[model samples]
Target: MQQAAPSASLPERARGVIPGGVNSGQRNVPGLTDLVITRAQGASFWDSDGRRYTDYHAAFGPPLLGHNDPDVVRAVAEAGGSLDLCGVGVTEGEVELAETLVELVPSMERVLLTSTGSEATFHALRVARAATGRRLVVKFQGCYHGWHDSVSLNVISAPDRVGHKDPISTGILPEVLDATLVLPFNDRDAVRAAFAEHGADIAAVILEPVPHNVGCLLPDQEFLVTLREECTRHGSVLVFDEVITGVRHGLGGWQEVAGIVPDLTTMGKAIANGYPIGAIGGRADLMDMFSSRPGAPVFFAGTYNGHPAVVAAALATLRKLHAEPVHEHVFRLGERVRTELPPVLASLGVPAVVTGYGSVFVTYFMDRLPHTYDDLLDNDTRMFVGYRRRMIDQGVFELPLNLKRSHFSYAHTDADVDRLIEVTEAAVRAQLADEGPLTDMDGTSTMGGATRC
Candidate 1:
């Protein structure tokens, strides 16, 4: 196996002052810990120690176009010199982005801007409740809407807890879980039963149209159609959490692929090409609930909502996505990776499956592709952990946690895919050859590559 680059002691020392040695909890995996990143460009990143790697994590799914694209940087610089924040009124960039989004997805007649995907879902849920006058919300077992208490339940919960409908995280009030109903994915009968039992009380059914949280599980055509029909039959709103699948799939996202229009759609991550921006979009009639009225109790307001810099970045990103054939390139690159990577793993006698829809994909170590979170739970995590470690050592960066899916960007080329597959094959062979402690390497304890709160 390859040796790791010299550790960045500065970040480790700064950890004494900065809690957990990182700004976000996701950045700090217990045994697979690393310090601050020094720089990133295109599909590659360098750590503080100057070690370079092909970045498959892609900023946790925001770098659809790639990191530090010249167009996005130029847009940010221009917008930074002028208007940065627009608290209430509309800006030219914001209006342009909103109009472009509506044109891209005609089902979205209106949109509400926010700073993060979590905030977008939070506001969308409120709008649904206000419009339908309902109290319950239904979400799938492994679909993650964001960090909000209401939608945070059942995101990769254990099999036992999932079967019992228990919240995945602690400190969430029992009442919050009570208002949220959890069900298995791709289960038409279960969804039908949910609508039958709480049809009158369900305000919305929120889910990632293409679930990526647990290894890019795609729903069947019948299941997508069932959600559309069932939501219409009952008065509940159907929400598509396209935060990860928004532009990664197509200009219109999973809605276009599935051929089903939802009542509301939440988008983030790549919306601004790595700039912090989120949008809640849907039919004008339902979105109008956000307007202040005597009887309307829904309130959605933020100081940084549609900030000019982020909006300008979004406009530039959208323009690039439209002006260039980015999606076509993404499809070509995706096909190469999906086609070439798996067989390479198999050649090395490593059990693996490459699953994804469009530019985003995951390398899962399982006998077959998983259809649900339960299937993902049964995967060989030990092998995955070993493989991930070897990949890192071989200068390929994926999410240290195997459970969390990795992503690809338009910046990744055929050459990048070739290098990744080559390194992955070597990594697997190395892992299979080693008999060392699978739990520890180089004095760092491995976290088993499992992601949880």
Candidate 2:
């Protein structure tokens, strides 16, 4: 791949204008200069320097159907040309989208649309508290539920800091952090202990049904079943933060896979195929709290909650996802990447593990796949940075940080996967030859050059 000239001028100017030379911190890939994307289509994006690369990140999991999908684009443009925002009123598109969602996820009887995943989660937590009359909430480490202060605790924190709760942001009040409990994911014992201590006071236990942050970590069947039973026993609401995993995993999500239902499930990202939209839906009884009655205290309102354009896009995306059987392609593509990529890394004597479900997964530079944020932190960071730079240079777009994960979409083909794997293999070989072996931040080589699969 020919090296594109670095466009440092815009980012340098942005440093003084924008807070972090970017709107979102996640967009700022570390080490290499930030490449500003100018245009995107199916499975690829063109940076400001006119370099095209296969977009494996998929805009952090929203582009399930791919960037600028023609169907979604047409829907959005047609809807926006007429009705853009119909606040507080029932639009035909909104109603149809809601109906589509309810039919797709049988667990979701009623759906309330919002603008972003964070707002959906915030509103869901509020509904849970109102329904249960409890103040406490529980979440697992490494599971990011957007930027809300409540769910911001324990996300991607250092492993040495485990067992002690830490807030990701400074503005989050100590009282708020106190109200939210942090626990290790895939560990029923930690959840059991937390419930034993403060189960009665807990309003909800919110978690990413399939955690994609800090590398993809899937929960065990027993762990999910135990959560359902315990939440039911304590009369606490179980909230599945399926913002990333919702339609990406399947039409039904992890709940469908695990055979357990959550009282409330939050969905975003691919729900609208890159359009900005989020939804919280589940049992009708719990969702009834959002009723706009004259006397009801519970309030959930957003000016653009069900914007017509987004609704139109969502309805189109969902219909296409189901009608076209996108999940089958996603699963097939995911299997190829996960199975073939690990051995390529191993052949180069690079220790790494590919962990995740469906099309969204992460290649962690570790020996054993991580179970907790602590375990993830024990993996190689410098090696990941090096590999990311090399992969990017080789026309593959991946998250440049160790803690962050990569995503794939339905738009990806076998050729895309092969290209990505080839570039990854080259990157792994380069890193191993140049750096000898990858080591954790603490300079440990526990991650022997071996494949966990």
Q: Candidate 1: RMSD over Cα atoms?
A: 4.5
TM-scores, all candidates, are: 0.93, 0.92
lDDT of 1 by residue, 117-217 (tens): 99999998988988888899999988888888998777766546766665656899888878988889999999999998889999999999888887689
Candidate that would win on TM-score: 1
**How far is each candidate from the true structure, as Cα RMSD in Å?**
4.5, 4.7
Cα lDDT of model 2 by residue, 250-337, tens digit: 8887788888899999999578898899999999888888855356678978888898888888988898998996888888888888
- Report, for every candidate in turn, its global Cα lDDT versus the true structure: 0.82, 0.81
Model 2 CA deviation exceeding 4 Å by range: 1-8, 291-293, 436-453
Q: Count the backbone clashes (under 3 Å) in each candidate.
A: 1, 0
